[model samples]
Target: AMAGLTTIRGLVPAIPHAPVAARMPSEITSREVLFVKSLDALQRRSQLSLRGSNLAAFAGRRTEDERSRLKRVRNKEDRKQAFKDFRAVATVVSALFAGLAVYLKYSDSELLYDFDITDDAVSIIAGLLFAISFQYSSPLQLLLVFFGKFETERPADWVAARIAGVDDPKAMTEYNAPAYAQVLSTALIGALGLVTASSLSKLGDTWSLSTAVGTAFLSFLYEVGRPKRLSSEEVVAREEQWSDFRQFAEARLVKAGSCHESEIFDAFVAAFPQYRDDTEGKAAFKQLRRFVYQWNPTAERTPYGFYKNVALSSTFEKGKTSALDS
Candidate 1:
């Protein structure tokens, strides 16, 4: 582990990744140093266990204890990977925000427009740069990758793992907890960046700091907290979903003037068993409730609040009656 840390310190600058290089600092207080040192010691002692015939034996003949331990390790690794992807998405967003801040900071303070460079030329150049950015490794590319129609890389077989009975043979695939941790972790990383940037600039008054912090928190949720089932769809499709099921629930509640929270949850689960039973079902459930609550803020937040909340929400009541009346 220590050796790997040392290698990273020496080799990171050589790599062409500016973001990572920018983050690297004095390593004396880094926990990664200790982690690397431990890893190095273990590797030197029994590297063969990870290679050759020993590897096959390790893979095939895991004891019950080893299997359990490995399951936890696998879950942690999966969460780590998911964090990385979400963070990258947020990074693009944050970078764009920083660029915007730079422009805003300089727009009126300096005369960027002179006789040498007219505002028209500046506008043209900006448009050209924006157009060029879409084709390169920029937020525009990521936006397309996120929202544009693409070939489904996830094959049907990946979801076909028989993970019904935990008491039975351990499924080759593993499930993870909800994205609560991922959201929190991503939010913290963003907060840290905001703080560091503010401290360095020495210009983070309450309003500016608040804006930076809010941007970070919001970008993290936009990128990470949304469930896969609820994401990667057209805005129209997503809006349709919101209106469709929200109305469905509202209709059911109007008859009773309210329903139990469990009733609503069961209704959704019944309609989308595949989604509700999948690994991310809990996350999807949370997303559904959050969406419902947000669209109709009068919705209750108690165990029995759904029906009453929905019934009381004037926004929901108006929409529900108008739709049904139509």
Candidate 2:
């Protein structure tokens, strides 16, 4: 401990014996700094708050100006969120490539048991970029952790409908917003991943192009085998028929003395509620409708089918006999 203390004491000039209360933290660190050794402004700015001096004010102003230089967007909050998300994404991507570059560079140099200027420069650049990228580590780390949540938990169909201009209030709250947030998060991660892989490795070269293409191909493969259910169009059509049938059978139809076709269909559904919404029930209803139509299309009042009669199936009534007539 004494040796380490002496080593540090040698680097720092002797602080003349002074009262403990009299020594300030800045006085200790700033003495050597006045000699003009290159100090990193951004590195210090990260620790300093918005206060004091021209340098601090300059840093604050530059930060604000840097924020405004992004693409013009209608929503200020949205643009701000986008910047945070992408920066996080970039940090993760840079770390990944930097780590890989370290191993690759070290391994390649090991074959001859020597290092060259090119290898050293590449490794240094990668290390520096990784450090800068991860300067504010927490946000990007959280972004990585949440990536899976967005990809898996978001409701896809409702989000799709919202994107296509469906403005349903309930859907917006229950499905659209949550799902949209997830999708946006996932997109930011993807954008960062692609940009990092391509830019760092060199665009249009085998590594970048192959990385992009492979990611897309794997995504395609995953989707192609995924189990898909009924389409939105088919669901809409089926529900329309189901709704109309439900209203007609339960509300409009009644078992009155007239024994109308609608009444008979309603009776069937009432007896078999399990099949009430099934295709079989719909077929039976359509069959009963034929019995309710009169032979003359111009007539205001049509005869009702009180009982089963095959003759009622025909529109022609020249000499058709009904079992109900007996």
Candidate 3:
């Protein structure tokens, strides 16, 4: 059926070549059987039919591109899962290996003698365990201190804004510690663990220290290569300042009975000179929007994207005048 272009006659020579069905009745003549010549022709027919469907292009059913894209996404997800699985397995295996080495050092096991497990090998394994401790310390901080300021917490306003469909905000809280400080802490704690374990296993200091330093260097190299995205204390300070600005803007908007973004920014800058130097006025604009969207009860957004002061705009004034006249 998928063979290259060929006529019915060529496909089946036993059929009559008279371009009519020989098995048809004498009164009615049989029409020549029409068939697709090849797989490409069949594909063209299927595509044509699909294209003729309602909104086929918009519905995205005609193209293989979407399917190909989905397959690529699935492949990437599979690769990611594989890496995670491998990491988990490596972690478990390393822990078990370190435990066995430590046990062999303490116990006069015949298996240690049989396997020729030397003191240097046990020291290296212990060092590797220390390196693993350092590798895991940053995340371990999360486990130890639940409220450690790591910039991973969602701000109240950010979450509210997302729920209101205003914006998709990133977690941008201030970190209490710098990257180097955190890294130093990890090293200190890992070293402490190594020293503590040395008491139990009585590891050879020379071999253990060398392996520990080498493994620690390599592990920390990966950490150093990662891009630092430190959220500053200034972010929290600025957000606090924005809260004050929101109050100021809301008061001004309510007092004026109506205003646009520029008017609000001008008034805000007059009150708080710190925002005056902001050339883009992005912060001021965000505050004003917050006031209009969430803060003010009587504030109504105008068609032109400004607010109409329900109490002070021209429409309100005219209505007041008409009521007085009546």
Reference-based lDDT, each prediction: 0.43, 0.42, 0.48
Which regions of candidate 1 deviate over 4 angstroms?
1-244, 255-258, 303-307, 311-326
- Write the candidate numbers in order of decreasing TM-score: 3, 1, 2
In model 2, what are the clashing residue pairs, if there are any?
Answer: none
Score every model by TM-score: 0.25, 0.21, 0.28
For candidate 3, the TM-score is 0.28
Per-residue lDDT over 1-326 for candidate 1, one digit per residue giving the tens place of the 0 to 100 score: 54665576566434535576457674732555565566566665655645655755554455445657866876677678667654543554355445544564567645432311122333323322322222112233244456753322111111212122223222222223224433333333333443344343334234333444444343343444333321223344446556656766555444323444555666666665544433335545556666666656675555544444443233445554222223
Off by over 4 Å in 3: 1-174, 177-230, 255-258, 290-304, 308-326
Model 2: lDDT equals: 0.42
Better model by lDDT: candidate 2 vs candidate 3:
3
**Candidate 1: how many backbone clashes?**
6
* Residue 39's lDDT in candidate 2: 31
Q: What's the distance in Å from true for residue 128, model 1?
A: 24
